[model samples]
Target: MVQDTRELNRKAVLTALMMSRPASRKWIAEASGISAATVTRAVDQLIAEGIVTETAEIISESRGRRAVELDVVSNRSFVVGVDLGASNVRLVVADLLARPLLALEIATPTATTARELAHWLASTARTSAGDVWDRVEHLCVGLPGAVSQQKRTISNAPNLAQIEAPTFLDDVENAMGRPVGFDNDANYALLGEQHFGAARSASNAAMVTIGSGLGAGLAIDGRILQGDHGLIGEFGQLPVGPLGTRLEHMVTGAGIIRRAAEAGIDLAAPSQLFASDAGPALKALRAHFDQALLIVLTATTVSCDPQTIVLGGGIANSLASTLDRYQAALEQNLRVSPRLAPAELGDFSGAVGAVVAALHKVYADLGIEEEAFVSLPGGDALTHERVQAARR
Candidate 1:
C-alpha cells in the first residue's frame, strides 16, 4: 500500500519495536500506548515494507490467536558520521540503530577544494565500509567552523583557509548523490553530551570547551542555538577581567602556560601546574578559572538559565583532580546555580554527534518523529546513579 510511517500511531509502534525487539502486536500496543488495532496496522505496513520483520511467533497472553513477534530490520539501512578536523578526519559507519560497524581515522590531507574532500569521503567509505556503503541512507560532516545558511558554505575556520569556494558543499553533495548535513564541531561536541553524556536531562545547557581555544555549545529548549550569522555560542569572544582577557585566553591550554609565565613561574603543562597544592602557578590558574567563570557563567546563567552546564576540552579534562573546585567555584559565584558536570565522551564527541545528526536527518526524511528513532540522548534516558546525584 506504500503507507508513510508518519502517523502518530505508526511512530509509536516503531518506537516500541525499537525499544523491545521481537514484540507481538499486543505487546507493542501496551508498550507504545497505542490501541492493538493501530499497532497491528502499523506493523503490517512496516513488515510489508521490510522495515520490520516477523521474527517469531508467541502464544497470545489472552489466548486469542498466535502472536507474531516483530523487530526492526536494522541491517536494511545505515548512517555515516564524518568528523573533518584541522589535524585529522574521522569516519564511523553504523546501522540504522547507530551501532558502529566500522570506524577509521586518518590524517587530513591538504585538500583545498570541497570536491577533493568529497571524493576522498566517498572513496574512503567504499574502501572501509565495503558492501555496507550501499546501505548508507544519511550522512553528516562535522567541521571546526560555522556552516553557512542552507549549509552551502563553511566559514571562519582559519585552518581551512583554502576552502573559500562557496560551491564546495554543493559539489560535495552532488558527488555523493545524496543529501549532506553539516554540524559545527563545537555545537556537535555539546550535542554529543546532550544525547549520550551528562546533559541528557538538560533542555537548556551550556557546553563550555576549554581547548586550543574556548567556545560554547548552547542547547536551548532541546535545540542547538546557531545564531543568525552562525556565530551563536561563540563564548570565546567574551572579554572579562581587569585587562579584558577573553574567555578564550583564560581557559585554553596555551592560556594556562602564558598566564603562569606572567606570574614568573615556569610550568611545563597544565598537568604540572595542577600537580602542586600550594604554588604561585596553581593560584594563578585557579584565579583564571574563577575570573573566567565569574564573567561567562554569570552572563550565560542570567541570560538563558541553562539547566546544566557541561565543561569539556583539553584543560578541563586534564585537571580531573580539581574539577570539584571548578564546580564549587561556579556555585559560589552565580546567583542561580545550575547543574555542572564534566563531559563523559572525550575526543570522539564530535564524531558521535555527526552520527546523531545523520540519524536525525534520517528520521526527518522518513517523516517519523524523533521518538521513533532516538538517535541522540533525550531527557528520558537512563543515566548512572552517580551522575544523577551529582547533578542535584
Candidate 2:
C-alpha cells in the first residue's frame, strides 16, 4: 500500500511536469492538486532516477527568490522516427524532447518490400543514433497507409505493393530491440507541425502534404482527429476529378510529372519539374497547380473548415514561389478562405511527430495522465472567432 501510494504520487508529479513547461515545484503542486511537500519529494525521486533535470533558475521579480525550473532530461532516452515516402526514406534520431540529434535520407526504389525497407530503416537509425543507440526506447514509422486503430495493422497502401503477411512493424522492432509505434504519414506530419511548427498555437488546422503521394492531416480542437479507423484526413482518395482520379492523383509530385508529360514536357524526375530553365515545363506545372489548388481549396472549405491550411511535403517546398498563385486561386473560389502558409518544419514534420508520440507513450508508461502542451478547444467560441479572422 505504501509502495502504491508513492508510485501514484510520483505519477501525479510527472504528469504535472509534462503538462507545464519549465515547471516549478509550486506549479507542479498546484496543477497536480498535490501538496508542495509531496511534489518536492516526488521531484527529488524523479531527479535521482535521471528522468527529470533542472533546466534553469527562475527568479521571482517581486521577492527576488530563485526557484529551479525542471524539465524532462532528453538524453535519458531516445526515439527513432522514420518517414518512408514512396521514393525516399527519411530518418531522424531524436531525444525524448523530440529534438533531432541526427538525420538521414535515402532514395528508395519502386520495388522495395516492407521487410527489406524496414531492415534498411532500422540499420540507418541505429547508425545515426551513435553511442545513444542503446538508450533508444521507441521507434515510430510514419508510412503512407491506414494504420489500424488498434495499432496492430497497416492496410490500403496500394503504392507499397500489397504484401502477404508482411509485418514491417515487427521486423523494425525486432531489429532495434525497442517497442515500435506506427501511424499514417500524413497524420504524423500533422502532429509534428502542431508540436513544433507553425500550427503549434492553432486550435483547428489542416496540413496538406504533396509528395510522391498526397494526403492531409487534420487537427480539430487541438487534438488530432483520428477517425474510427485511425484514418481521418485522407484527402488523397477524395474524388475531385473525372474518371475516378482522386485529389492525390491530380495534385501530387507524381501528378505534376504526369501532367507535364501530358503537355509534351519530358521530365526525368519530380525535382527537375520545377527548374526555371524548363520554361514550357513551368507553364505546364502552373496549369496543373491551378487545377490542384482549386480542388484542395474547395475541399478545405467544405470538409474541416480549418482556420489555417499548411502546405507541406517534398513538392511544396520546391515550388514555394508558386504558393501565391495557389493561394490567390483558392481565395478567388472560396467564400471563407483559410489562411494559406508554407509548413515551417519542411520534411522534418514526420520525425518530430514521431518524437511527440514517443514522449506521450513515455508518460503513459509512467502512469502520467496529463497533456504535455496546450491544446485548442474545438467548441470554444474563441476558436470560431479565430477562424473568422483567418478567413479575412
Candidate 3:
C-alpha cells in the first residue's frame, strides 16, 4: 500500500512535468498537489531513470530562490504509428514527445489474408524508420474498424480484408517485436485535430470522416468518448438516407460513385461528381450528398452538442463550398449548432493521430491520461493547474 502510494505520487509529479516542462520543483509540487518532499523524491527517481532530467535554473516564484528546472527526456525512445485506411496506409515514426521523425502515405496493399497485411505493415514501418527503427519501443495502429476495449482485436472493419483473422494482432506484434495498441481510425483523426489541427482550442468537438466510408469520432470535455461497447461514434451504421439506407451508402466515396453510375453518369471518382456546372444527374447527386451530410451533422449536434465539428477524410475539403448550406439548415433546426470547419491535416490526420495514440500509451504507464493541452514537442505547454481550472 505504501509502495502504491509512492508510485501514484511519482506519476502525479511526472504528469505535472509533462504538462508544463522546464518547471521548477516548487511549480511541480503546486501543480501536482503533491508535497514538496514527495515531488523532490519522485523527480530524483525519474531523473535517475533517464525519463526526466534537470534543465536550466529558474527563479522560484514563492521563495525568490534559484531552483533547477526539470523536463521530460523526449527523444529517449520512439514509437511507430500506423493509419490503415480503406484506400491507403499512412505511417509515422515519432519520439516519446509525439514529434514525427518520418512519415509515409502509400497505397494499401491488396492482401488476401490478415497475416499478409500485418507483415506488410511491419516491413513498411521498419523501412520508414530506417536507422531510427532500433529505438522504437512501441507501435500503435489506427484503422477503420471497431476496436475492442482491450484493443487486442478488431471487428466491423469493412475496409480491411481479413481483419478479423484470429492471429492478426499477434502477428503484428510478433513481426514488429514490440507492444502494440489500436484504436478506431476516426478516433485517431479526432485526436490529430485536437492535438495539432483545427480543434486545438475546442474542448468538445466531433470529427466526421467521409471517405471510402462514413464514420465519426467524438470528444467531450477534451477526452475522446469511447462508449461501453466502443461504438459510440459508429456513424456509418446510422440509417438516415432515402428508404432508410445506411449513411455509409449515401455520402461515402464508393456509395456516391455507385449512385452516380446508377444515375447514368460515369464518375471517375466521387470528387468528379461534385465538379462545377452540374448537369441534372450531378445536381441530383449533390443534393442527396448535401442532404445526407446535413442530416448527420444535425443529428450529431443534437446528440453530442460539440462546440465544433471538423469535417475530415478524403472528400471533406471538397465540400467546403457546401458548408454554408449545411450550417444554414442546421441553424433552422437547433438554437445553437456546432461550427463546421475543414480538417487542417487533410488526409494525414489519422497518421498524425496514430502518433498521438502511441505516445499516450507511453504516458499511460505514468497514469497520465490524454488532455487537449498536451501538445506535440515544441508546441504550447499548458500547466496542469490551468487544465484543472478550465475544467472547474
| Candidate number with greatest TM-score | 3
List where candidate 1 sits over 4 angstroms from the true fold.
1-12, 19-22, 31-35, 59-66, 110-118, 163-165, 241-245, 257-271, 277-282, 371-392
Query: Candidate 2: global Cα-lDDT?
Result: 0.71
Shift of residue 317 alpha carbon in model 2, Å: 2.2
Which segments of candidate 2 are over 4 A away from where they belong? 1-8, 20-23, 30-33, 53-69, 109-111, 156-158, 162-165, 228-230, 263-285, 373-392
Candidate 2 RMSD computed on C-alpha atoms after optimal superposition onto the true structure: 7.0
Cα deviation of 49, candidate 2, in Å: 3.2
Two-way TM-score contest, 2 vs 3, winner: 3
Runs of candidate 3 with Cα error greater than 4 angstroms are 59-65, 150-153, 367-392
Q: What are the TM-scores, per candidate, against the unseen true structure? A: 0.81, 0.82, 0.88
Error of 3 at 378 (Å): 8.6
Error of 2 at 177 (Å): 2.2
Clashes (candidate 3): 0
What are the per-residue Cα lDDT tens digits for candidate 1 across 1-392?
33543466677777767666668888888887787777888888778777888878887757567877787787888877777776667676767666667666787776546678767766765676678778888888777666675546767666665454677777666777767787577787777777777877788887776666666778777678776556776666676645777676776677777887887777787556555564765876777666775566666666567988877766667655665665676677764577777877665567667777887787666545664443342332222222233221
Deviation in angstroms for 295 in model 2?
1.4
TM-score (C-alpha, index-matched) for candidate 1: 0.81
- Give the alpha carbon lDDT tens digit for every residue of 8-88 in model 2: 899889877766566898888888889999899999999999888898889966589898899878678877777777777
